[model samples]
Target: MDIGKQIKTLRLGKALTQTGMAEILGVSKSTMSNYERNISTPDPDTLRKIASYFDVTVDYLFNDMTDSPRDIIKEGTAYHPDKALNKDEWNAISYYRRLSDEQKDFIKGQMIQLYQKSSSSNKG
Candidate 1:
């Protein structure tokens, strides 16, 4: 995806309207619409602001690796090229990354408990 598409995808994923994103970024709604439609690109500062607001690196917006935010995970393991992540999965991972450690732990525990409950119920 291009930068515009990336921006649009992120904004839409968060259920934000173009005008809402424009206000958050301190730009005009027309500018935001232009950016999303690829008619024009944001200036450097605006680009930085957009990246920051999305909790993503500028590289994520600028690079062609939109299908995968980063080539390597934080643990230094590289993702296999064949297994490209879709937008929703990427959005989920992005949201998870923004969570605090305690929140992450709680979510993980909940997921584990849910999985165990489901598994036990299936064994009958």
Candidate 2:
């Protein structure tokens, strides 16, 4: 199944209207509709929000697994032809992709600070 179909199926299963999901994801209703209809793809951040709202993993959203949904969850990680992006990582990648060159430089600076902080914490 396509990502759009999977998203639509999951949304319908959860009894959520497109508008409702759009509101939660801070996107336009039309954008949500586009995603469901496969007219446009969701940026990674939006994909993460959708996965989080539906309590599913990114792999489950992108793959066609015949096994139980619970088993998919228990498996933790699975490869999908689609980008293998978990929620937060997807959001970060999406944000980076949308940045201008100057903005990307700023982001790199910020990441350097964060990485330094993390490394220092590990040493303590």
Candidate 3:
């Protein structure tokens, strides 16, 4: 769904009326209505307020993913060592670059099977 639909869904989920949400965001009810109807978009400051009110990331408001904000990390221009993959993991990732198409597919299928088995076992 688009940003407008996501915003409306979040607002309704919180049981907030347009006036209530507008009050929280320091905007007019008509402005909130326009936002929900996709007639206008929220500016950066307003977007930040909305995201904070919903306890979600700015990206969550804009992006298609529903994953938790904690799981999402924004990278800066300079990479941080703590956030970078370890040497072993990087080597394994690089190895995939050398694989043939058939090999890649086989590896992907095997990984999926393994994940499914692990998940099913966890449920039991």
Candidate 4:
């Protein structure tokens, strides 16, 4: 199960510090430290809250789920077997994730335009 490892993985995946996560959960920093270090287990309520906050099931936290949601989403996305997305692709993805809905649409439009240009060039 390794709940502590899963918690550490998820928290780090989300780029949240222990203090930040503790503040969100209304727990002391030491408590969060304890949970991540496997020194102490969080109560059921806290566990549920953590699961909810991370948008994962409680079973996932307790079970052996090796991949984080971010890893799953970004996996093989860039099409290079040796690695995931390259620096430019990674940068674009990271920035796109923070965009507003309208901005996202605009980016999609730009992508369509690029695709069209490439398609036309290929035909020529």
In model 1, the runs with Cα more than 4 Å from the true position are: 64-76, 112-124
List RMSD in Å for every model shown. Answer: 3.5, 10.5, 15.4, 5.9
| Clash pairs, model 1 backbone | none
Per-residue C-alpha lDDT of model 1 across residues 49-106, encoded as one tens digit per residue:
9999988788778676645544443445655656566667776778898999999999
Best by lDDT: 1
What does candidate 4's lDDT look like per residue over 3-47, in tens digits?
A: 888898878867999999999888999999999888998899999
Cα lDDT for residue 81, candidate 1? 52
Q: Cα miss at 113, model 2 (Å)? A: 52
How well is each residue in 1-124 modelled by candidate 2, as lDDT tens digits?
A: 5788888877776689999988999999999899988899888888888888766678778865423232312234854444444556644654676679999999999999999999999999
Badly placed stretches (over 4 Å) of model 4 are 67-124
Which one is best on TM-score?
1
Q: Residue 43's C-alpha lDDT in candidate 3?
A: 99
2 versus 3: better lDDT goes to: 3
Q: Each prediction's TM-score against the native?
A: 0.70, 0.52, 0.52, 0.55
What TM-score does model 4 achieve against the real structure?
0.55
lDDT of 3: 0.77
Q: Single out the weakest 10-residue window by summed lDDT for candidate 3.
A: 65-74
Report the lDDT of model 3 for residue 5.
80
